[model samples]
Target: MTIGSNSPTRQGQLSVLLAVCLAALILPLSFSGAAMATHTIGQELGGTAAAMNWITNSFMLTFGGFLMTAGALSDVFGRKRIFISGVVLFALASLGLSVAPSLGILNGLRAVQGLAAAAALAGGSAALAQEFEGHARTRAFSMIGTTFGVGLAFGPILSGFLIESFGWRSIFLSGTLVGSLSLLIAIPRMTESKNPDAAGFDWFGAATFTAMLSLLTFALIEGPANGWTSAYVLTLLFGAAAALIGFVALENRVRQPLLDLSLFRYARFVGVQVLPIATTYSYVVLLILLPLRFVGIEGYDEIEAGLLMLALSAPMLVVPLLAATLARRIAAGMLAGTGLLIAAAGLFYLSRIEIGADTMALVPPLLLIGIGAGMPWGLMDGLSVTLVPKEQAGMATGIFNTTKVAGEGITLAMVNAILAAFAASALQQAISGKFNGDEIGAAARHLATGDLARAAHLLPGISPETLAATYGTAFDALIYVLIAITLLAAAVVFGLLDNAKPSEEEANPVVSPGE
Candidate 1:
């Protein structure tokens, strides 16, 4: 583990290491690209607005739900075997997804894709950790981190081009190719690795956790379409509660638990973990809302919206590296808290923006958000584990990551619900005296589904100007509420977390458990 005493990597070892890192990087790249192309897919697929959210949620639900179990499975079985299996599954799913004829089929395939991604992501990183040691390993991981950042930063831009040039299907086709290439490299080169001491798989824990998340997400996404108190929504809410209770009980009784409940006792762990939830919620909510604003409301195409998204993502590329340096000088808690406040400032600024604002008007807030997002993703992650026992570091990382993705999935559904409810109500009230109930309902349905043309067709009696104003008012209110929440989260971070400096070891740890 020393710097100079590092053993030289064998000729082909570096290639295998790099391949594993690339495979890991490919998941985020593909997912982000798909997100950028969502508007195009929605237009072609002919689904409700909520269905578009489902496409993303389906992936996140499985990815976050099964991540810990997937990582453990890789340890118990063989990392190479799991990694290649995941690659194959992901490729096949992407292929099927590209040709999927209905939203139902597409969402099902996306769920499969997420499951595959979880396995590939966990196994690939574990393979890299197992294959190299000391300085060589450090460099290998640094490459992995760099690739990850680069992939996220570039994904939307590339997706924008591909979606414009070829179509949305081209996005999945590229993902299939990347998965296939990774599979080919892994077939011959990936070294098989497993933890000999790893215990039995926590099937009960995984099942309960997955069920809990899926149910909660289901209720949120469906609540607006079906009334909030509808039987379906109520059933899902209760089901999620039951699953959560069962998951806690099961994990406590299990021999090798999937989630260690004891770790939550650390006040620092609890406080630092909040940053991920707030940061992830803030980022993902905008990812969905911003594109809808640009394309659905403002008449920009997919390509234009994708390019604009770079303003939000580009800072993520460099800020983390800079923030890591700052970790050595400033307290991790303070750095993360300050970052949250900056992000809050950006969100508040964005809330004041006119609904009809152009791309140029968005850049400053997006930059501030990107800067804010970058700091916590690195700093909070470091601090979360730094205050914990070394033995529990892996579990802590797992929980932190689970929070990030799971929180994103659940919150996205909530955000979608909020938008749908507010917009529908606002539109209904705006046209109350002008249009009949039937016409108002029809227009609301069309608008809610992102079918602005259809809504226009149904609302001939209403002025387009009036319609735009109604929708804008509702959307702006959502942003205003989100701003309040962001600022509140910043306050919590500043008040609750201790201003403790992270150890040098914490700043640049070799292994990230949930990566």
Candidate 2:
């Protein structure tokens, strides 16, 4: 019950893992559910493209911004204390989301949910390291990954059923029900733990880093609508740059900085940073992008769209296993580099497909992309640790994990912004100055969301077919950019990781919490 008290039974430990797994289930579901439900959220809530984006960005932003801080808190305070608080807040946020009357309220609740998610993952995973040992600990930790994959693979189908049967609010309601069950199971059995040698809390460093991420994200999301050259956007960018400078200065001076700024000097470590950025555009972006394209632009229902998405997600279940096997024989960089090229090819193939093509026509490219993306999935975390000195492993893990979740949030925002800009440019060129600047900007945002109907409302005489064609063209251009990013990451990884010898640990990655 208290620090290092030791819960003495396998049954109790498993019970605790069940609770963690349940919480894990809610994490990915919340992410994919918001994506699948964004169009519907917009239909009922009435938000601009930038505003509707808050549906996903608000959640990822706070989750990433606070993730490392939450991990440190679990060590200084008590693991169970922090975890239970997180589960409670996560549950309450879900309940609030179920009855949220406006988009503003929904996104606000989502931001709270992200914060709570960070706490739950940090505390729950740390508690596991205390409760189990050796192989049991590995097994327990692996369950978190398995649970996340399951939630992601099934989230769309489940959320679609909830929406069609009970409307969009039910997605959050599902979170409420699961969170309550997790709380009930974990409370009586959970034990507390802490690191007695933990350093003093770095409040200033945390604040500066979070401010930097927040300002940059806001600038990216709002820049397309406000015009990239607008004074408001420029001011936000300037503030973000100032915050970055302040954060770097603080980290350099602090006794125990949040991030080890010197890690940037290592080629392998810098190359490791590219992995998450590559995946965000190559695969993660589509988690939201395809669902919107299918359901919003192509006139498919939730069920139909979810079913089609299976082609994209199903390969993840098995490919990572093969990737791990291959890593034993081949260098991780070569294996993952090859995979990125494969994914890039898939993107090119996907770009060429006609809009509203049949599911059968779409399956090959989507499946190819999934298989390719899954290869690097298990290698990234391992490389992050093995590339650095063994003494610096902890810092490497912290920095890599931050890049993963926080980097993911920022990258998603950038992808959304770029997509909107491309779509707006396409729209403008098609009509050749028929629409005013405000109308063109608004319509472009709508088009990016795959809301051709709302876009039609903005452009009165534009036929649906023509609008769909324009959207497809813009989307194709975005895919080209994604392909370029992926290939560039592959080249960097192959060159850097070549000098680093392969570790046996590469096959079984050691991930941080809230993965």
Candidate 3:
């Protein structure tokens, strides 16, 4: 089960190992930038604001919903087989997306790509887990986390370049190439790892769980736009609740379930799942808000905004490795808690940003946030997997991913709601002073749509200088809300987490002696 050990030349196998990890890295990059690109392209193609939301939400819905099922399938089938299938599916989806004639087709393809991604992600981690053991496993997890950090951090900048150089379609075309290459590499070199004694595939549990997650995710993403009180939203909410209740009942009755509902009984497992969700929520919110704050309010263009975002991503590349090394000496919980505190401090600093604030002013806080965020993200997966038995690894990993994705989905909706609320209140106050409420509201709406020029026109009777200052005030209010969320997450990490050290057995479980 060790990587590179059987090869005549260990270095050759190591190369293949690295390539496999790179393949894992490229999957996330394909869709991580979709949020920004979708926002931009949706507006250009005469799509409404809601379309922009769907561009991101659709992918997340499918990706998150299928993750548990995909992981379980890998455990029942074979990791290499699932990995290759996912790569092929992703490649074809990317090809279709590149030339899609309409938003509907593009969004559909993106959802397919997301499903493919879930397969690849689930299989990749399982492959790595089986390929390496003990300390080597720890390093493998760290490497995978580092790859994810780098991909996500650089995805926006890479997307900006592709959009500027070739066009929005080029982003998908590039993904096709990466996916195709990953498949080619994986098929020949990747080894199979399936539990021969694994229980029969839980088809019923998988179907019900997928339905439950899809319904829940749809409600979370759509509720804000449709008005939480709307009949459509209420129906979705009720449907999700019913589906989830049914799923729980089904799991409890099934012989082999996709999710082990009993895992939450362990305090450490609970912390492992909850911590990632909070951290990822904070990460995604910053990813969305920072670009808007920079390009929309501070008047930086796409390229400039991308460059500024690099400040947040750059530290992600290095900090995870540092955290992994630190984990050998310190407890994972301590590292995670410290990282959260550092990220909170960074968010507090970012909240003080002004409309015309110097771009360089943000560099320090962005670095701190990136470094801090990278640490826990790097270590959490390994920590989470170690908390359960070897046979339950796939199920436990699925639960971990589901929580993180749910956190991400809920956070996106909640943060947007907070921003809208704050912006509306600020607009009302500004109108009472002298500004036109309708104009400011129109401007805010336009700004949200990625059309700054139209937004500018909505400001009346104010000098250019004064208008800039007013917009800065509104932006500051939104940042304050983000600051609050980050602080809350930090508090949870510190107060709830048990700062216990992971045992060797906990870190790497042995197969049962009888087995």
In each prediction, how many residue pairs overlap at the backbone (N, C-alpha, C within less than 3 A)?
0, 0, 0
- What is candidate 2's lDDT per residue for 222-266, written digit by digit as tens? 888887899999998999999999999999998767776776776
Model 2 TM-score?
Answer: 0.90
Each model's TM-score? Answer: 0.88, 0.90, 0.89
Off by over 4 Å in 3: 1-16, 432-446, 453-475, 495-497, 501-515
The runs of at least 3 residues in candidate 2 whose Cα sits more than 4 Å from the true structure, single-residue gaps closed, are: 1-13, 129-142, 264-268, 381-398, 499-515
- The worst-scoring run of ten residues by lDDT in candidate 2 lies at 506-515
**lDDT of candidate 3 over 388-495, digit per residue (tens):** 666566666677776776567556655655555455466566556666554555455545534455455666554545444555565567666656666676666555
lDDT of 1 by residue, 1-515 (tens): 32234356464476676566667666666667767766677778877656777778898888777666676677777778877888889889999988999988999999999888877766665666566553444455445545666676777778888888998888888878887877777788777877666677788998898899889989988887677799999999999999999999999999888787776665566676688787865665776667666767677777788789888878777876667668668866677778877887787777767766776998998888878877765566445444543333334445765776678778877877777667778987876677776566556644544556667777786666666677677777777777777677777776656455555334444323321
RMSD of 1: 3.8
Clashing pairs in 3: none
Q: lDDT at 366 for candidate 1?
A: 86
Please give me the total number of clashing residue pairs in predicted model 2. 0
Could you tell which candidate, 1 or 3, scores higher by TM-score? Answer: 3
For residue 12, what is the lDDT in candidate 1?
49
Model 2 global lDDT (CA atoms, 0 to 1): 0.80
> What root-mean-square deviation over C-alphas does model 3 reach?
3.7
